[model samples]
Target chain A: METNNRINVERVEHKTSEKMKKTNFILTAILLICLPFLLVKNPVWAQKKESSLQLSFLKKADQSKNILLTVKARNEAGKFAPAPNASLSIFIKSNEEWLLIKTLISDLGGKASMKLADDLPMDNEKYFSIMAKIENDSRYEDAEEELRVKESRLTLLLDPTDTNRILTATVTQTGNDGEPMPVQEAEVKFYVERLFGKMPVGEEFVVATDAAGKATYALPKNIPSSDTLGNLTIVAVIENNETFGTVESNASAKWGVPLQWEKDPFPRALWEPRAPPAMILFFAIVFGGIWLTYFFVIFQLIKVHSETKIK
Target chain B: MKTTKTITPLIACSLLLFAFVHQTDVWKAPESAKAKKNPVAITEASMAIGAKLYVKECLSCHGKKGRGDGPKASDIEKPVTDLSIAKTQAQTDGELFWKISEGRKPMPANKKIFSEEQLWQLVNYIRSFDKTIVKSK
Candidate 1:
């Protein structure tokens, strides 16, 4: 009975070893079949993502000043990081279409600046449309941005003979067809041009344009001019707007009613130093007295030394 | 009968060759545009106005001589056509007017910006760039 039990156990062990070998071979074959797929890379889905671009005015650019366009780029991680060595194309929208004017490359900080040419006819339009674009980047898709340039021309008219010296201004906006159209409801501010910029003319500085795109302001009697001849340069300004940035025009007028205070060269108060004659007299007297005392002291010392030596 | 068969095949082959040799331009204007005639009269004044407009609007992409060698030509994906070339000059004024109004990609539509008279004037201006033809005339 013991010999019969030993033979049965040997048979069971042989069957178990064969089953283990078969399982190992099957797993090895499956791994070999899937190995190529595991090693091969999938298409770069990250590169297909859309790139983002932002445009801003670099400095205090205005209608009178040349425009400085600044462009910034964003990375794949949604971070506003510098896109160094990237090219950005700048375009200006004319009457017909957008014309590519210049191309700029970003610096280490991913900041690119493009200064518009000074001679651009900015007075022709109330708002200029500028576009910046980055095309066919390997890592990022195409990106572009359009920004509105606030610019316009203001025409100032002065009526001097009227009982109420009214300064009238007409605000005009240029259409895409290069035609000037009246801009209604635009706030036009009148200023008297001075050596250091401009001074407001009257209490009602800001007035909105009427239906005919005209704004009027009553000029005060005592506005000062640059010269004695009552010649004044009055500027009509449409201040900065979100759409139409800024526009200004100037007109010369003989309406400057010079103040009596401006005409007088001498100051009325002691603090006001208009080459003070009283101060000059006082200084001369004080200086002369001190010098005379010094001279007297020197003469006495010299006489005392001479007499002592003789003795 | 043999000669007739030979001539037929030769004629058919010749026709095929002719068709291949004289392929039409890739861009085709609408039937209405193709049939229409230019309304604006071509004069020195109109050409002068068109010249100014072209310089301001088209000089960057289309060169001063209409040679498609403007500064921005290479940056654009599509090859800019040389307006001075005979192939471009062969197109009717109406066709050119239609294309300018309804622009393709990369080129903005100019219908809003230019009036019908202005577009017609542009056609005259572009034709003025064909000095060879102008001299011949």
Candidate 2:
């Protein structure tokens, strides 16, 4: 009876071992099948959760100065770090579409800077939308941030329709995108360039832009003309404006009262020729004296010849 | 052989997907725009007036024959749509008017420059490009 019990127990243990081996084999097979999915990163999943890029803007001191921007990158672990050597591009929104302005590379600290060209448009109000973007980065998804800048522009027009010689100076305010925007209550000073320097014109040296972004000054007809063609160099200046820095527009017009030659106050006596009696008399006396000396010498010769001939 | 079988179907599917994606990118007017009827009647006199206005305004960009080959057409970043094409003619007159009144980038909005009646007339003039459509009208 003891031998029979031992055999049964060994058989039961062998069956149990076989069952355990089968279970281990199934688990290993399942793990092997799913290893690639678990270990290898899926691009679709990576795209769903893109990397975050943070951007900040530093306002420029003047509209003519460069605008400063800073960029920082965040890792998948949500840690902020400088994105070194990343490519960045700047763009401005024009008619709802972003127009590329410039491209730059980030430094080791993930900082990038750029400025609008001096000739490009900028406005005082956030009338312009500026965008900064990071491009072609695999480790981090592409990112962009938008900022508003204050850029101002001024344009001057001389009304050609005014027949009354009314020196009408019109000032039009424009934004960075070259859109005419009304600038109410901003003082605009009009000046005419002279041989020496700019001379302020109009009874009111300062005028204000109306609701239509237009400021009209009855350019006093008395402003002296600068050229022979009756052309005047008119300058519309807006200095120390809170919105727009020193903005000025120079325009030429056939307006302004000409510098009348008759009214010229400078003394031209030395250079200008005039038939003055005193000068004419001096010239006549000098010539008369020379002629008189020549005639007397000729008369003496003639008398000596006559005497010699008579001897 | 197995890899070839898999890659062939994959490439075909990718091409089909690409074509489908780009097909939807073409700008299309909303159903609301399609439903709105033209208020102006198509008439020869109106076309004459619109033709004059087109020469003054759109001729620089849309060309004399409405072929999108005007002098300034190349200066714009976006390609000017050929008004003589069937695709342009397929749009309703109201949709054309709306597009002109509320222009997109590289195109100036003419809402202030042209009146509502004038915009409708321009729609008629653009439609006159299709002789069949003109004959039917």
Q: Each candidate: how many clashes?
A: 1, 7
Poorly placed runs, candidate 1 (over 4 Å): A1-90, A93-127, A131-146, A150-153, A174-180, A258-311, B1-137
TM-score of chain B of each: 0.77, 0.75
Best by TM-score: 1
The worst-scoring run of ten residues by lDDT in candidate 2 chain B lies at: B67-76
The CA lDDT at B137 in model 1 is 85
The alpha-carbon lDDT assigned to residue A243 of candidate 2 equals: 50
Query: On residues A156-264, what C-alpha lDDT tens digit does candidate 1 reach at each position?
Result: 8777677688888987766768777788889888888899998988777999999888999888878776676888888887764446655667888788865344566
Single out the weakest 10-residue window by summed lDDT for candidate 1 chain A: A58-67
Candidate 2: the clashing residue pairs are A121-A176, A122-A151, A122-A152, A122-A176, A123-A150, A123-A151, A124-A151
- How much of the true contact map at the interface does candidate 2 reproduce, as a fraction? 0.00
